[model samples]
Target chain A: MSRVVVDVVLKPEISDPQGQAVLGALGRLGHDSVRSVRQGKHFVLEVEGTPDEAELKQIAETLLANPVIEDVELHLPKD
Target chain B: MRIGVITFPGSLDDVDAARAVRLAGGEPVALWHADHDLKDVDAVVLPGGFSYGDYLRAGAIAARSPLMADVVAAAGDGMPVLGICNGFQVLCEAGLLPGALTRNSHLHFRNRDQVLVVERADTAWTQDYRPGQRIVIPVKNGEGRYVAADADLDRLEGEGRVVFRYAGGNPNGSSRDIAGVTSENGRVVGLMPHPEHAIEDLTGPSTDGLGFFTSVLKAVVAA
Candidate 1:
């Protein structure tokens, strides 16, 4: 089995409204334990066949995310 | 002149952007996200879409692409770079520009034709239009709001970096109704509107967006 991991982040200095809203909601929910909240997503896939690391990186870069506002890192399981 | 359009993962508008470039009398070069070579294009355009599925943040992931390193270097060398929507996010994420795009204040994915006033006509992307001219373009995105500190906003305004401001209603709750902006040198521009989708009148919102493409061509030729 082949596994691919995708990591993402917002561009630095760009405000994250989603994170702010979540933080507000946390305060209301009495989870004030949360000091800061930043929202982001991740994707992990298992493919049938082996694909080169470059190709997987390309896939993650082109169709998997928007480069303008999102940052991504791709990791493959070690052989 | 050849214009390179970078295609990042989740990029939805590279094809349209390339077509617009071609329609505006420039050869469109397709640049892959993994490739470091810019193929010797005169200018570069980072198109819109949900790169990395808007994961970590809009344009944040894609900004680190190997290809972007070249873009940043070239842009610093004064090669014109235009980032539309997601592309704009990438520009900001890549540190090629300032400010960040946040989610719409309404928290809804907005897609509509927007009217914007030309705030700056001296940039490579807006040179075709006169200052204060109003134009319509399509804007579709969930994270389209713009935000910056008070001092940064003041600096931008003082330096005349504001490039486009919403003319009618603010569609995405952008700060000061800002729709676009330019770098200090005026060679790099980033806007939330989709100019590529506005190039063709038959199928798109308005033809006003065509001027952006044509403007870049003129600037390149004159330079």
Candidate 2:
């Protein structure tokens, strides 16, 4: 079995209210050194044997992320 | 006129949209998201709700549903399609409309009666109202903020595709205070407010929303 990780995040130009809220909470909790925070979703997929890189990219682009407002990154095992 | 109201698994306002169509003197055909059939309806309404439990993102999964393929094809041919609230999200996700509806800047699920100005009355959905007319309708959503590329936003404004603009106050921090927008062909419209919920004075804050249904009926008949 192989695992692929997908990270979906809002584009930098778009506003992130949830991430801002979390940053505010962190400030209240006295995490002063933090500069900024942007929230994102992480998905770990377990696939049979070897995962196809192209299929994983398609899944990430078509479903895991919205290209209009989000960017996605894929983490795959080294061949 | 027969208007189809599509119901996804978690749709909460399909019945209300149908009721609005009936009130507008049109027959309402119920459509399912899992089917490809459009039921020969003259118009289609993508009603609001957390379809697919809003997984991944609001309206993301539902946008790729089977029925949406037909909806997109029909919309391309100038069939009138109205999407309300989550329906608006679906329309954007399906690429039937430009821009994306994102989380509200306030970070809360807001529900309230909002005022909007009809900026363009030439679309299939807004013909009943005069330009610059003000209407009160219930706005409800958690992720309703509208965002788009700056050039695209400017182009929409330049092309007069912005159908409605929030008046008095912006409910969700939408860019340019846009409450609703229409496709370039003017037959498809998607908005973040629940016009279905405001079709009747007895249950809604005002009867202003009836114009949307009535306008579409007129458009279909005229076409």
Candidate 3:
């Protein structure tokens, strides 16, 4: 089995409405010092069967990650 | 025809998406964000929702889901993929399609019935419509502004990949009034409007969105 890790981050300068909303709520709740909050997701997968690195990369580029607004990284642990 | 609807942790439209697929005469398969299997579906629909609670950006978190790995592979092998609303955001973020969705110029969440001009009818999700036809669908989002480098915009326009454009007035201040776009091969499509919500006249503003689903079915049959 091969394990792949995918990380998705928003592009700079793109205001995250959800994050901003959260920040506003936080301030309202008396939590200061949280200047900003940007949210993202991390995905880890364990694929059964032996797939080559090229195939894994293809998966990351095409479906697993959006290249325009987000960047992704794949990690294959050595057996 | 089995179509897969991917459900990210915060996905809100998978059920509606499945209903639309079923109404359009296709089976809807539920795919999880943490699963790698695509369930051998024919097509895939990345429904709009606050995936990962719209963290970092809309669709940014959900783009890295486990199922997306399989989705990317299937899309490359000619499997049709449609990204709607947040789904469209995910598609752009994932780099499956060009451009990025930014905050609405008004910096507010706008939701209303929107009129769209069909610019490209050859794509898998738009074949049922004629070029220049105008259809009304609902669009609701906060970060729905579409942006791209000037050169990229020119290339997208030059290549005829600008599949849908807003008519009458720009709702979200999208550049060039773009509402939807397709990949170079026309296999992948992403639109900012919610077609799944417009499939039924009684429930939605219009049934114009049904054509998108029917169009894909026809494309599959023809292929």
The numbered model that scores best in DockQ is: 2
| Descending-DockQ candidate ranking | 2, 3, 1
Number of the predicted model whose TM-score against the real structure is largest: 2
Q: lDDT by residue for model 2 over A1-79, one digit each (tens)? A: 9889999999999999999999999999999899799999999999998899999999999889999889999999777
Candidate 1 residues B118-149, lDDT tens each? 99999999989999998888989888898776
TM-score of chain A of each: 0.79, 0.95, 0.68
Q: Candidate 3's residue-wise lDDT over A1-79, tens digit each?
A: 7777777655554555567788888999999989998766677878888757898888776656556555677777677
Candidate 2 chain A, run of 10 with poorest lDDT: A60-69
Q: Which ranges in model 1 have alpha carbons more than 4 Å from their true place?
A: A1-79
- Each candidate's number of clashing pairs is 32, 0, 8
Q: Give the Cα lDDT of each candidate.
A: 0.88, 0.94, 0.86
Q: Among all windows of ten consecutive residues in candidate 2 chain B, which has the lowest summed lDDT?
A: B193-202
lDDT tens digits, residue span B1-223, model 3: 8888998888889999999999999888999889889988888999998888876667877777778878888889888999999999988877789998987877789999999999999999999999999999999998898988667899999999999999988988898999999988898999999989999978999999988788888877776
How high is the lDDT of residue B99 in model 3? 94
Note the B-chain TM-score for every model: 0.98, 0.99, 0.98
Docking class of 3: incorrect
When superposed on Cα atoms, how far off is each prediction in RMSD? Answer: 7.0, 1.0, 7.1
Model 2 accuracy (lDDT, Cα): 0.94
Model 1 chain A is weakest, by summed lDDT over 10 consecutive residues, at A62-71
Candidate 3 A-chain TM?
Answer: 0.68
